[model samples]
Target chain A: MKTPALIVSGVLALLLAGCATRRVDESPVAAGQTTFATKEEVAAADEHDDWDTVAVVEVHDPIEPVNRGIFWFNHQLYTYVAKPFSKAYKSIFPKWVRHGIGNAYENIKYPIRVVNHTLQGRLDRTATETGRFLVNTTAGVGGVMKPADKIPALADVPKADTGQTFSKWGAPHGPYLVFPVLGPTTTRDLVGTAGDTALNPVAWVGLLFGGAAWTTAISAPSGAHGVPDQMDRYDMATKDALDPYISARSGYIQYREAASER
Target chain B: MKNIFFLLLGLCVGAMTSNASTEAAEANLRSTIDQVLVVTKKGKGGQSMANQLTPILVRHMCFESMTRRAVGPGWRQFTPEQKAEATKLFSKLIIRNYSKKFTPGELAEIEFLKPSSPGAGKVEIPTKTVYKGSRYNITYRLEDRGSWLITDILAEGISFVANYRAQFDVLVRKGGAVAVIASLKQSLERT
Candidate 1:
């Protein structure tokens, strides 16, 4: 019952994210360039004394209530709900199951990577696919892929080598927003959730709801084993964080950069 | 259709009944953990147990959610060049963080408690993970699937979302999402 509701609600939420409210005046990109020029230039600009010409740039966009709502929804679902569930699943499943779930997700995306690589005319993508397929099928399936062998090549594909589905219907990257629960996301990525749902095979796999839920329930302990460590690291990063919004924004940028490299 | 529904009902009922009797589940885990420990003691190399188990421990708790939250936004902002750089660096950083936690000579143990009644189509499973020999009560609230899939965790009183939020907030504050991400990627690559 909740599944259908979630799906339907997600669609509506995406629509909210999709609302085209352009705030042209507020955009930094509209006039062009960063408020803080590079140190060398700032020093140069100071020496020349173009301080009066310097202006803070900002991106202006409509405040989409719907998108905010959807963001909040995902936030609650993940922070308060899905995250805990993941821990539970870790507790019940054998190492094998974890590997299986990991492999399945990687495998399902293999074709997308293959297509992306083929389009790019790049050996890197092909190489990555080969590695992704092999490791995911063998080591990942076995739940014992050596750290040396765990490199997922598919994740290495260039963004330019995006899947056909993405190029054809990919949502445009909207203004970046810090979601309350889900963390950082742009409007486009938010909409991507809808697309992901439409494409998710879990609905057919019979693990999405009832069956998978119970299994996760049992596995929670294994998942929770290292939560303290993760928390500790997070604390280190944010304890003296001057401003959460800016920090989160910077972190997301760094994270995306890292994701692309992977 | 009626028969199928009946079968589904039967399965649901059986699951409910079985889950209601969770003493067996707790006992089963206790025995398994104990057996693993016993094997480790008798094993030729103390290293074997640590090597065999630490990966699972790290892999399971590497805190992918933190990375996900850290990466999900500004995904579109990155050029293919920036994106690639960011992704690889971030992954390395995450791995490094995990490596730091699962350090040598740090004693850690995980014990399954009992399952609570399911809520919001999910269930709460209690456990305690002793890290560096300090036991902290942890809870795994899981959503249902044919086979369970873990998506989140809570340790002590901190939820995964909160932990990630703290980290991400720093990023956002430092440079908006994009700047935060860029610096993180730079740091990850530098390491």
Candidate 2:
């Protein structure tokens, strides 16, 4: 009996030793303690199999504390204010009218697209965007209708923006950051947003028309026109996410990369 | 020539049958999801209701595949008992999330795009789902294994399986199977 027991103990010891040498898992393993608590863990988890093949852009988030705080702020702003306002606006207006308003806003932003396309050295895309703008402005009645959409060539021009232009210019996305209302953006992209804003006629509404009321009137509807779609994306990313911040950050990067490439 | 004609006829009939099978799979998924939403939307969604949902979800979702894939290469490291525990835990976690995820009547406004074949034995149903005035694009990916069953879901391009895998990969790499099981338990409890 002593000999058999000794053999069993020896075998258990060997198995325990093997387990110790192989995996050095220092996590506390406490229930309800740490569920995707850090982005470092996500970034550190590398390609182990085919499932990991889906590219999740890993961005350096040095100001994660600030970003998280801002992320929380943006989420609240969207949920409480933006969402209710949009719902009210939707109730007031039919979808087509809102869609037309949205299209008009998109049309107003064409200068940014065209200029960025030119900067990116895509003359063909620049031409297509210019053509789209002209067609939508004239026949579509100041972009309320997407007449250009009927033309297959003008329909699917990949949207170009100042951030994509910066990417094309070989600028790296430096330090991920989230703004209070603006949500997620990088330092380079923030600068790019400023550049794009400069190109936007909506920003000029105050200077050209010259009144806070006029700007607000234009901005309110413009924001309402597209805010729902963005909120939708935000909800999708964060709804069932393990870590909402990491999920949003990774998603933002992946989308930006895809847009730039597209 | 007669043999050739018969072979061609058989091929045509097989093609039609396959197409019908694919359509049925998509229809089945749509029905299953609608049923799930209906149950969730009910005033009193009790343990009994959840009990009923589990079998339907089990029938339609390939939980084992999702668990294996989400665990990544470290799945091989787990002992047989450990593997079984991990799979069971993951299924519970996923089902809990799935059952409770809808925002009041989100699926009521769902507009399912035509299901398309991504590859052999796989079909994808893309839908524009709405909740609280927000329109979300969610794509359900199903694999045919005797029956068409969901393997993964992509919400606005964020994959459900890959999302967990990122977190699990870290734990699996650092602590191994025990760590993953613990974290999964933690996630289930919190949700």
lDDT of 1 by residue, A128-172 (tens): 666656665665543233231335434333332231222223223
* DockQ values, each candidate: 0.02, 0.17
How high is each candidate's TM-score? 0.36, 0.64
Interface RMSD (one decimal) of model 1: 14.7
lDDT of 2 at B123: 78
RMSD of each candidate? 23.2, 14.6
Deviation in angstroms for B6 in model 1? 89
Q: Among these predicted structures, which one has the highest DockQ?
A: 2
lDDT of 1 by residue, B44-89 (tens): 3434544455444333332333344343332334476665555555
lDDT for A18 in candidate 1 is 31
Compose the digit string of candidate 2's lDDT tens values, residues A76-131.
89999988977787799887887888888989999899988887779999999999
Q: Identify the CAPRI category of the predicted complex in candidate 2.
A: incorrect
